[model samples]
Target: MGTMAELFAGLLEGVSEAVAESTSLQGNHLLELAVPDDAWRQVLCVTYRLERRADVPANSFRLSAQASTPLPFLVQVMTEDQQLINQVDFNGGPPAAAISGSLTSYNGQILHIRMSLDGNPLVFHLDLGQPASAALSGRLLAFTLASRPLPATPENEQWPRSVTRQAFVLGYEDPVTGQITPPCRTMPPALSSSRVRQAFLDLTNLGIRSPKVFPLLSVPTDGAAAQAFRDALGNVDTDAVVAEMHQGRQLTATRTGSGAYTFRFVPDARYTGPRLLLVETYQLTSVPLSYGPGRVIKTFTLLPGERTTMRVSSYRRSSQSIQSTSSVLDSTSDESEREFEQAVTAEQGNSAESSKSFEYNAQASASAKGSWGWGSASASVSGGISGSNSSARQEFAKNLTSAVGKNAARASARREVTVDTSMDMKLEEGEESAVERTIENINTSRTLNFLFRQMNQEYAAVLHLVDVRVAFFSGHSESREEVPLAELDSLLDRVLNVPRTAEVRRQILDLVGATRDLTGNTHPGFVRTQAPDGTELAPAVDPTYTSDYTTPDGRTITLPGIVTAAERHVMRTDGVTVDAFLGEGQGLDAYSTGLQEQALRAQAADNLLKEREADRLQIALEIARDGDQKRAEAFRTLFMPTQIVNQIDHAAVNTAPVNGKPSS
Candidate 1:
């Protein structure tokens, strides 16, 4: 059993060659047309029964047809002017149309005729064995039947077969454009029915059962060489000495139970060492035979019970681009102690502090001399003695005593009325005050603008900071006072009670705040408020916003949508060809990104497998060649037996005597 396409193609295999020979012998010029020669044969065969007959008129033939099928069939008919005629539906046989006419030859291959179909006169032209347009313009009539599975049979033991309707086209022109389409040969036909196609499949199941080869070790039954070989074998584990060889081609070895082994031993026989062996190999392959357009037969041979595998193929070229990306991130940190120190330094400026102090001291001293006072007392005593002279007689004696007493009294009474006074005073006062502050300036306008403009969607909206200001102030203030004499309230009060004491008092003051004036030289009435270091305005809508609008069809348009559409349009315009854009076709849903990714992965896997297979085959070939070389080298190194050595010397003689005669 075979597919309908295969049967028809095989039946018309030699028709083109036959027609060519006939036309050449007749010495006629062939006409180029749109229909294939095999197409003509297929149509003629299914539509009518053809046979060689001498009774027919020269270069003429009658037309008639009766076609049927067990399964549903589709029939279509078109006139020469592209008008459809009778179209029979599948599941019902076509009504037999009574057609009688004589084919009149217009050229070597082009033949025309007027047939009476039902009642109308229809014209038909057949271009035999000539080039045709991709789509034939002449009348087209075809019958198609669904494929049916074949019954069980020995020929299909390994692979099943099915019978399908043959594939053929009478016209090649597009019905709408009246232009020729691509050749039908580019399309895949029904499955093949050839037996050779299953060879690879059968090989997968076939195993190498008990492959044998000549003994690796051959020597005398009983000798030192044989004993040595035996001892070597005894020392090694027999199971461990496994030899596994993989070859790409068939291996040659002695068949099991084929014949007896042979050997001969003589004295001083050198043992043969281990060596590799090489064998020439062969394989079975396929060769394709193409008889006509869309007709191919692959010739091959396979083992018993193996059948061909049907294959269908369609080829097309398509390409796309894939993108892959890699990303990385880096993070860094500093010690917390260092960060704290920096913050403290920035907040508090390092500067000298303020101080104030007050000090006061006083001292008084007095001294007197008594020498003048003693002299005055002596004069008073003398006056007192003169007043007492009235009593003269006793006065002389009293005068002496009085003189002594007056002298003592004078010395004692000489009290000096001298007085002296001195005073010393010291006063000290000090005051100090200071104000320290820090101001920091920073700008981030560029970074904010870049983020708003570049990192959003393709058609992002305008964004910016508005009415935003940042200010920081760090300050430090210190005041110091020393009052060691504060406990001396009475002295302090006495000193402070003076008229200039209040005016001489020390006062220190410190003020810490944010001030625009770096120098205190400014007037006290001057305003401290100053202009900001920087300002940021609100963001306005981008000009591209106007491009977004509503369509007349009521579809709302957005900036992002517009941008996406523009990009997609550009990509498609650049990637697609003009012909492809203008030509008719189905949507490219089948070639989506997901499908493309899967296909690429599969292709990569296939390539890797192919490379591995190639490497394995190469290694096998090298092993085979090395085996052969090693065998030859081993034989060269072997020492010949004494008998063979002596024979070689005798044979080397120029003129050796044989049977008492000189032999040349």
Candidate 2:
């Protein structure tokens, strides 16, 4: 199932479109509030898709929203009075003009929205057809290592003097690669329930390993064009691929059996050559039909073994559904749906996780880097945050920006053009002017902030960095050592994260081209910590605690096995929005940093309180060690608990070698 965030995005967009078509509001208003820049706990938005057959001059579209109930968050479309008015007054001069609008709420009601866009902003024409609603569906299979047959115990033993504890390690294996993936284990729900145990049994019995439930597609290695895509598949810009795939009204994912999916609606077939994008979605809202308030996409990787592992379960229970919406089962009436749900308690404790999705759907949502355990980094950063040291972050941002700007400008100022010397100098100067104009469009701050946030999470983009360590002025001491990242300490982690795991593994084995050499040496690129030119950074750091996932039999496993994929829909809800990237989220980054600063301040305050406590205890100990004879004698004059307790034989608190009694 999609993390709660994707669910809300897809559902809200669907609802908004349905409402737009259903609403009485008019005009060519094709405004969709699906922009990632705008967000909410649970919100609905109206969007527009324009279509005009011929060139025209001046066209308009307006869409309005009205709801009977008070909507919590209505982006773009509403005013102070909750009055929504989205209007396209007129596109002037040019035959066609661009349009942008905000959003309002939506509901079950579906509408027929008429859209028109004058290719030249001249004459407007309407396009018809119901925009399809996109949904996410998938199956969740949770598993654990099969228990080694317990050392045989006496068959008749009933005393239970020796109890064999079952060590519960939570995660699943990949269907295609047999690699085990461990899910993030933070605030897990109650586990003592029969249902969860049932799930465990169901998954354990499946016997298949590896979550690459989707069957592998063969990439054409013969054709020149095909070969190029195949070669680049090992390392490509995640955002570019996602952008290309989502460049339409919808992207469809069909289950091709064995819990695998094949995607459609890709603008370029070459992109689908070696890499596969998969997303898993589940409902977040309890409301029977509402998509949800938000979704959660903790981590995803171009490589499958990044954040989540997949296991194929051919054991589809006749009517059984376990925390998923992607199962093939007939839906019973609302009264009968309850039959599938029941609470599971740990064998001992009452604490447990809620059984949410028994079925789910997954598709591609590219994550820049595979999961690089950031808990230690977050902790270490807390130290750097002390004393309001914002200068470091600011300096880094400035330096990075300066470097990028210089490079862009330098590339643009290539005076050595292979030009006909006879050609006018105006042509070259005009090109320079265009380059200058392009600079105005680049929002460095927006791009920088996004990069900073991504850097804070994982640094796999520059996979050459086998070690990540950096020195910071921590309050504890200058140059104090810190353990930050331990799991992502090798190339194995990077290789697994690359798409087309099976093919990549085969290539590495054969040592073909850039693959591992006959000596089993990894790709040449695998032997570096810093980029050749040193633009990329791979900090050398360690983990806070010992992180070992080796099996009992000495089989070592690599990290980031678990990945979070989301359904790539008509509208994106699970990514950094266009508006945000274009400077809208500029100050938001600073705000986030401020929040981090505040958190550090809290930590500092906590440290201060602890120091005071220690000092206070030390002073008390010194006073006692010296002499309080006079004070003790005076206190004894009063009827104290020590004296009173002695008389009643219920004494307490007088055992500290006082009053000449043998210290009891």
Candidate 3:
């Protein structure tokens, strides 16, 4: 039983060897004949002239084989543990074959091959760059191997197992040297065309296209060179349009230094028409730098249906340093004079710093103002002391004060004045020239000088009074003290009242007369007095009445009517002063009696009106019935009897007291 088991095992091994050799013959094989110790896994294909053998079908042969199904020719190299290292494939057709054209060997060694058609095994040997006596021999054994049948025993009732092939090494070299590198004994694993197609699909989904998916190289940040490179990107037609089957379209591109940028394209269904995407790039420079006078650098990218962000930055340089240098030199002396020079230099340095700071602020302010259509102007003056011991504060104050004064004076002197001149001329000839008339008209209308003269006089008076008041008040001393109310009132009264202001009083009276004149008959009773200025003066009276009193009989009386005529007469004259006096005459008495009679009549009428209307009605009826006769009778009854009696008594007294002439 032991020999039988051994014989079976040997038979199976022989079949496996034959199967392996047959598969190698059908596939394109890679042979690792030799390798240096330090060599990495680098493979190369070398072509050489193959020497033809006389009896081997001209060193090339074609064989035709048939299988139940179309079969692929696969070749692989692996270890005994089934870890595959290399693989290759050949077209499974009798005519599609790889011809061996080279007799390449491992290192400087040669290989020997023998072939037989009688089903006998072929043998090969490798020299390994060593002596021929020390060469290794490999047998190409052959036997038909069939799939093992299932065992009937329950313990062995399993499916057939796949056999794992092992890789054979022709020779090896020292690990320390790279010389004598050899071809791989087994083919590398075949790359799937399906896998390559799937990789390409993934890239397409990522919006990668030809020319758009190129690798980006890193660059430097030197300003000009970087700008040049960016400009060049605009001229490059490296962008490609990619359409996705599922997702929307997109554009992918890479810059030299920066990373990749992807732009989404509008979907085909939604796209109305063709569209292009434009991209631009710019470099933002440091604050100290500026773009040239009128030139700016920009980069642009144009693509179809894509969105991209362009970095744009402008550059500018500060003018502070140059401006400061020029300003400092122009404003100062060149010669050094003792410590003063040092102090001046230090001051100039500080000024320069301050100016630079101010310039920045001014620029900002100016920019804002410019946008708003407004502008601003500013000037500053700084002064420094010659001695180090002097305080800067004191010098600054002095300078500020002087500057203010100078500016104020300049403004005052620069006052805008409009002047007019006029000339008056008699006609020197028969007819006046138009030019002469115009000149005359201009001269006649020249009133500015007069107005200015008047204004100057008034201004001088005001200033003189102000000065006097200021002096009297003792330089604002009075401002610190609070005056008593009574004292203030007295001062106001003194300022307001003046006894010698008779002329002013006369003028005021004249104004009152004129106002009364304008009021017409409403002021008919106003009497005008003649003043020394030949002006007629009238007593001031308020034309507007506050209240009116009515009698019981409905007779209205105003306050002005309340004053007696005697009182008005007293007011009109100055205590009966003599003017071209003749004597104290009866004329005044007659006038007085006449005035009194008129007053009596008016009073009587007013009294009668105050009585009951019934009484007035009865009297009026009686008078109307008897006509003038009844009125005469009533008057006689009330006055004639008394007067008649007085006259009779006077006659009797005259008759009794007088002699014979008295009776006459």
Tens digit of per-residue lDDT, candidate 1, span 72-96: 3333333344433334444445643
What are the per-residue Cα lDDT tens digits for candidate 2 across 1-664?
3244465456556544342111010000000111111111111111122222233222222322222223221112222333332322222321222232222232111222222222111111111111111000011111111222111111212111112222112122334444322221101111122323333233234322112111112223345534343333324333433344333211223322232333333221110001101111111101012223222212211111112222112212222221122211111222112211111011112111110001101111121111111111111211332212122222222332232233223322221112111112234332322111011223223432111000000001100112222111111111112223222223222213333333422322222112211132333333233544886544222222112223222323232211111111111111221111233444347777788689889999999999987986675566578778775555446423443355565655454455576675
What would the per-residue lDDT of candidate 3 be over residues 561-581, giving only the tens digit for each residue? 111111000000001110111
The numbered model that scores best in TM-score is 2
TM-score of 1: 0.13
Residue-pair clashes per candidate, as listed? 19, 93, 24
In order of lDDT, best first, we have 2, 3, 1
Off by over 4 Å in 3: 1-354, 363-390, 424-664
Reference-based TM-score of each model: 0.13, 0.14, 0.12
What's the C-alpha lDDT at position 49 in model 1? 18
